[model samples]
Target: MITLINNPVQLKRELLKVVQKELKDEELKVAKSDWHSRRKPIGCGLTIHPGIGCPMQCSYCYIYDMGFSVHATPYSLSGLQLVAALLFNKYFYPTRWGTYLAFGSVTEPFLPNILPKTLEYLKAIVEYLGNPCQVSTKMVINDENVDKLARVGGSKLSILVTVTSLSQYVYLERRAPHPLKRLELVSKLRRKGFKPFIFIRPLLPGLRAEEVDEIVEQAKASGAYGIVVGNLRLSPNIVKRLISEGIDVTKYLRVDLGKLKSGFVDVRVDGDTQTLIRERALSKGLIFLRRACCANTVSQLLSGYNDVACPSLCFLNEKVCEKSCPSQCKVKAGGEPKQFNFHEVIREVLGFDEYEVEVEGHTMYIKLKKPLRDEKSASFALSYLFRRRIRFIYE
Candidate 1:
């Protein structure tokens, strides 16, 4: 082993040989369970990862643990394979109401090498599925691909531009474009008539009230249609990375070192700060969102909602009841709401083995590993299972 390490050229050759072999061994396939109850303010239904790992290497990104950090092994689906997988899925919705496709969840959809393929994949979705799609990226946008994206996305394309921090961009997003440049790109997309939303994700825990306001104002000034703020979801590896970069993880957020679960070090910002952020956005006339995804924001932007409060209406608004808001607003409890027995009925009818159900008052957020074979069938099953009229968001 020592000799192999000493001979750098030989080591490189051997590693290349193994990597090529693994790539060849990989099979053409798509994700089986595309639906998820993710933490982002984007819908987690029918997520597509055109490529397997992200080269950007954001220190805090969860994809590091989701099978993308291993430099030796690369994974991705080909255009033909992606189209085939999507077409073969029986659970996909035929119309826009039931089907909202999201891209770039696990991998950067516009990585330099994979950008062309990503465009191809989007075009295929347009031709075959015709489902509304959403994408968030930190890559530098160019005229060539931007035009292609417009063609593929058409009127149903929702864009999320993630800018965690203008100050911390150098440290956190080492490989991605500058935060200000990303804002410029957002403005450009807005000029193109795309509904681009700003995502201040992993909202560095201890951000000052003024700092939050600044981000909101800047995004709004940049022509962002809406803004979504998210807290950092930290894992042990992520914490270690931050620490190595001299980031005071504790100062940014609270970390329960003893309560680590699923390889993640639990860290979260206080609710008061999040509330303050929302208030600031509302005061600035910007569309603020809480725990909602890009799809929800786009729905609110395109089709106005009723029965929603002035400040909170623009945020946390869902396009249910024929793209209308709910009759009344109800507060939801945090930290994964409990699932009731009605979920069992959904499971039995939809044939889902793995699922999560979050019930907030009368509203139920159900996340299925695999999409339902038929949206109407699932709705019918829910209607049959529960006599009460429960608002449900199927992810």
Candidate 2:
């Protein structure tokens, strides 16, 4: 199942042991997940699923299918999920820094009953772990827990609010809060000095252009630092459910997934519609990005990069390493197409991580002693480093 996408040397496809002695347990853990298909050299990606099940059930959510809780269960998760991953990774992967610890990938982090424990969990990560983490949810939030996250992890943390339509009738998500309420929370998050981002995702193929614009405008007005838009993919069961519920989604979605286990049906977004959305955000000077690898496309990544400012400031405590890019870059999947000395490029430019390197053709993948990031330059530099190999990373 691991397609090489035309890798010339296929070093990445080699066994993890190829870099085993060079990587730590944490790095190895990161290597375990397919990264959903990203070939970046970022540190690690941790998803701590302490809170199971989200009440704000979006019909399009891919969670329940994963068997995470449909209800909040703080005690259900390994309390040490955060600390264990960090300490172990840091112990072994000392030089490389992982950029994110995404939450709510399995369940919402701020469900009402889960909020109190969720706060405690946030406390655990920020206070105990060092990696900057992120989460996106649709639940209505008050300030108490937000403060805990900020205090513990600093701006190295992020809370993404998932709001599909500002329209009452839209109800793209039946159980979640109204779009207006989400707007209020976005503002509150920024006022408290935290960087808030919006995931106006699963932009259903039926989502009207006006609806898309309204979401973007509202996110901007609510003081969101950026917007990560995602499109809706039809899962067989969800599609059937929506049809039975009388929801007309055909025009808004393009995936032919009426039957389960038929494999993943490709979903196509109307190019013109996508263009309209991106253009509006660019005109308004907002940072717009797609939410996934193949879903976001290469051009979306190529456009709208106004964050010349050191985005790490938005990162609270974790040192925001510059993105390691020698220059400004984009919404693209990989980075600038070029090669680097895996060990030397970042070592010379950012001055961190003492590790061994392996170079294959135009690409140079690093095995860092520690994870890197604190400044945008460092982070971008990593992507820039990977861009050299991107031409073959994605086919």
Candidate 3:
């Protein structure tokens, strides 16, 4: 069972100590070395990888640049150990309103070899942490797998079925399941009381925009609650692979492709294309989301977890927060922010008691006597828990 503590600082420390005491040395070692034990970026929460590598070598995948193998392997940590690692993480907060846990970032979480580990991790997260969990997949999930997932995550787990290109699936995602079959999985998920969303991620240039209407219409027909559109990011290797697959790479390139050696280059889709998707989605009465966190937040609200607004505070940005969104975040934000012991939270997170906190509207300004050791992680946890923008002033 999960307990709610009014003081987030104490809650985090107590949870960490309890989890650490229960873990074995081997578990602790695995927990310590895992990358999930670090603070993720502002919009993206901690990415939980159920496995390493992906057998479905999509042409646009960038995992190869990150040193992941083409062959898949389940993550080494067991469910309990994975939970312990998350608790040990300085940035992680546990509960329905806590840190967002996203899977299928680096590898396909629902693959046959890795599905067991994925389910184990999901069960443990739902049982112990109760954080908002989400999984994205291109694989066609069977009835048995769907039932298992429903039993474990239920409404708390947001499902994102990736369908990048219908006509070009053979060239782009050759090994993955067909787009139509994946849509069928969406229908099944909806029938089982899950609000699945069609994930049109990496909106491939010259490919995805053409089929926007058909994709949105099919998604709505398949009983998807909404559509999430993501922009494409191209790494050098990804560009090479796409070119080799007989896909055009000229229009997406602003600079010479050869000049880019390391890191990813963002390819912004045309505004008209984005407008088209948003309009189509809204016409179908389907919620259109630009960020994954928005979908996660909506799923939690619809699941009856809590009425709390988005932890990322996306409601402040109109572009990302859809007017058609059923979440009452904007209205909730208009009300008074949740009260927290800011002084204590600061002391617990920063490991010092020499800071002064000032609150104005929805933002908290912390005047620090000295510099923090890990400002990013501390700010992320505090801001997420309190749903306030944290600004540290060095005096």
Candidate 4:
């Protein structure tokens, strides 16, 4: 630990404490299973870390446990081997939905530090793994990279902008590009004909709920395909810092420490809020949907029963996103937490483990973890399984 600071020895030590705390702060335990989930919001999304650590270094980020606080910088692409390195077996168990890989949760994907070879590794996952995928980012992406990704993504690539708060003063996102810039990216995405969506997540407590509506409207107008709302889940220290910031963030800081003890944040998106968001969607006349972790629009659609809801981001719209929100993740009362099955993803992108894949009822539902090499065969199988001749595109 190189001593970092201005000299009064005491101040120097204090500064080191700050750095150590920020980097090692209880490790936001982003284990493989922890990152991977079955019933999330972004259409069967995969919250994979392309790399570890972040350049932006936002204080409120939930990924401290990635254990990369002190690296000179994070890895750009979580090298395919690194993916296999995630403690969670699912990373290697290999069923299939390798289709919907997500980037930027644990770190920013577009950071300038990541070299081409790294990006190639990320691209190879989709191309050779045989599944369509998208990445979420907050970095200021350049036109050249966008062009490359656009060319690569074609119709299958998606760029999701994670904008939590729009107010510049909120500084919740100090190093990240401004919300306006993110909105601009949406335009770029549309121009490139790539699917674009806005993830207005981690709704800060002090910020007015109106910010939600403003963002929703802007995203829809800016050529966004849709909007998904999520709430902020804070740790005790995070909540303390938020409230101490001299704002009424307490309204949304209702996280119970008990839930965190159980391994995930208790913050949830619920009823009245869901209804409120839904009404807003109806008024706006847009394709409005909500997601948990990975499912996004697709899971919202899959969660046929509309009564479930997520508790966070319920700061505004009591009933809307709630109306469509799916059930929060939970351990089945009688058994183990349901493992995120990769059957659908696998069968869709590969077919080596040949079998009659189905559609409608049982076809889409899957149990993850199949043979690794069967990736391409799974992609081929989905065509027959779905009985739809749509070509599966990958980046």
Q: What TM-score would every model get versus the actual structure?
A: 0.66, 0.63, 0.91, 0.59
Clashes of 4: 63
The runs of at least 3 residues in candidate 1 whose Cα sits more than 4 Å from the true structure, single-residue gaps closed, are 1-43, 70-80, 251-254, 258-261, 265-270, 292-395
**Candidate 2: tens digits of C-alpha lDDT, residues 235-286:** 6766765666556666455445445456334354646665676677766766
Best by TM-score: 3
The digit string of per-residue lDDT tens for model 4 on 19-74 reads: 33443322323322243422232332445555567756565666664356533254
CA RMSD per model (angstroms): 13.9, 11.2, 2.4, 15.6
Give the local distance difference test score of model 2: 0.50
Per-residue error (Å), model 1, residue 231: 3.7
| Candidate with better lDDT, 1 vs 3 | 3
Model 1: lDDT equals 0.57
Give lDDT tens digits, candidate 3, residues 282-341.
988899988788788888877875666778888778777777777857676542345455
Which residue segments of model 3 deviate by more than 4 Å?
39-42, 208-210, 253-259, 328-331, 334-336, 339-344, 350-356, 368-373
Better of 1 and 4 by TM-score: 1
Query: Could you give me the TM-score of model 2 versus the true structure?
Result: 0.63
lDDT of each model, Cα atoms only?
0.57, 0.50, 0.81, 0.47
